[model samples]
Target: MDMKKRIYLELRNRTPSDVKELVLDNCRSNEGKLEGLTEEFKDLEFLSTINVGLTSVVNLPKLSKLKKLELSDNRISGGLEAFAEKCPNLTHLNLSGNKIKDLSTIEPLKKLETLKSLDLFNCEVTNLNDYRDNVFKLLPQLTYLDGYDKNDKEAPDSDAEAYEKGLDDDEDEDEVEEHDEETVPGDEDEEEGEEDEDEEGEEEEDDVSGEEEELNDDEDDVEEQQGLKRKREFDEEGEGDEDD
Candidate 1:
């Protein structure tokens, strides 16, 4: 469908001021131009019009709240000054797969004070020597060009990273909970069984030790009594001989 009808359908009965994001990718445009979009979309923060055959952005209405713009896969060559005037708060812009040739074509983007990322993959300008370094130097405000910094580090996908980390954290918690649930009671039961066995063994050893001690004491008492009787009998016989 044409860009106008596609945008209207995307609204789905919501007014333009209430819309925060709009996706118009792969839609037909009027001779490579934006149409039906107006300044009434004051609350729009993101707008994607990729592959819409747009050659310029001269018709973009003032979107002071816009932060990200996707105009990739279009015929846009230059006239990026329109972005600075219309989407003054833009931070991310994708112009990949366009007819952009050299540094001069994108030099106008320097006016975008808040622009941090620019994607120009498949554009002629990427073939230039030191293209990345030169672009970074030209647009000092930009932190990334085609998803990499001047240090050649890839951009961090915050949302995806957060989601994966969240899943990992949840998995770790589940593992801990499962281990506690399955192992704790079994460990307690094993410990209790070991204690019971030890107590029983100790009781049997005490009983045997007590019985042996009592038998030894009885034997010693009997020997002492027999010695006393013999001594007394001997003394009595000597006294009778003396008397005779």
Candidate 2:
């Protein structure tokens, strides 16, 4: 038998306690060939670069002891649901350059609370914010992501800048509302001032009308008194001429 088949058959007969790490990367075995081996070595602590064999590896039971899994540069697809269901103790997972397109594929990985690093660089991922938030929500212990430190100074500064921009937008909206309110009051005050001036002018005209009416009444009374005095004077002059 060839070397690859020899290693494969040898691993099949062995139990889980016999191996702590296994690397079958770049091997000549096809898809289903590694499934039997994974069942035989389900408790492996490290597995790496088993090209085109990740989806089959998910069938392995009791893989809770696995710590590091590297499936980079492979043809792995259908998200990380199978891997998360199979390996709950994974700490380092490198799925970079894979065909993972959605965040749901990696949601099952939240059960691996011990995961500290994850790599999804150059994948079909288009939304980083949703991925970062969902990953952070799931894996709080993750400190390194896509090759960058989580506590990097620039990251927090960029977050603060985004927050400040949001606050500035809110403040601008409030200012616009206040300006609108102020203009409404100004318009109301101008309208009220004009109304008050109109009322004052009406009162002044009414007062002028009352003064003219009183003057006309006084002139009529004076003319009636003058006419009465002239008639009495004429009567007194006729009586004096008759007496003489």
Candidate 3:
């Protein structure tokens, strides 16, 4: 059996259920294509790294867990955009010795904000005069390229890195800021409490005023009864005087 079939059979027999890294060099992936051969290694569920050289694959299996992918010496001319979207969390990539001829083909890799390192040592795109400038400009999140500036000393004012340095979130001060957590949450609760208290106070005041009005009405009724009794007594006295 050949090396490709041998490796496939061996790994299948071993039953690599938790395997993460896979290295298949010279597996004739470019010649045989990536769909059918990748189906052979269906046991790789938690695969994170794929070092498959010379694979002219049009589409990769929806490997959401893959972090690093190395596809050197291949002919994936216009698939980096879909590749980046497929593996949205890739941090390391190596596409050296490929037939990528321009920056537009690989510009899709710029959206990979988590990508820290990239390798394009022998690709045809590296021959351009604006190669380094374009790469750094396109992928400002990159920390290392080829071998130069591996530490990313040039990106001191990177807004992406500012979050890591506690620039985006710096609210821990002795003085309170306008956007404080205590201000928003606590203010809502306090406002609601004040509204409830005001409503209760208004209800209590209305009850007291209603009682005062009832007392006034009772006093007026008593005064009207007294006036009627006085009139009746005055009429009875006049009638007695007339009889005498």
> Best-fitting candidate, measured by TM-score?
1
Per-residue lDDT of 99 in model 1: 97
* Residue 49, candidate 2: alpha-carbon lDDT: 57
lDDT tens readout by residue for model 1, 104-200: 9898899999999999999999999989889999999999999999888999977799999999999999999999998886798899999999999
Clashing pairs in 3: none
lDDT of 3 by residue, 1-244 (tens): 2335635754665554445556566554445356333433334433322334434455466556667777766655666776666666777777777778888887889888788878787878899997887888888998877745544455343556877667435655524565575577678899999999999999999999999999999999999999999999999999999999
lDDT computed for candidate 1: 0.94
Model 1 stretches with alpha carbons more than 4 Å out: 169-244
Scored by lDDT, model 3 comes in at 0.67
Which consecutive 10 residues in model 3 have the weakest lDDT in total? 45-54
Candidate 3 positional error at 155, Å: 15
Q: Write the per-residue lDDT of candidate 2 for residues 136-163, one digit (tens) a residue.
A: 6666788777766655422234558999
How are the candidates ranked when ordered by TM-score, highest leading? 1, 3, 2
Deviation from native of the Cα of residue 65 in model 3, angstroms = 1.6
Model 2 alpha-carbon drift over 4 Å, by segment: 1-16, 53-57, 126-134, 153-244
| Local error of candidate 3 at residue 148 (angstroms) | 2.7
Query: Local error of candidate 2 at 125, Å?
Result: 1.5
Candidate 2 Cα RMSD (Å) = 18.9
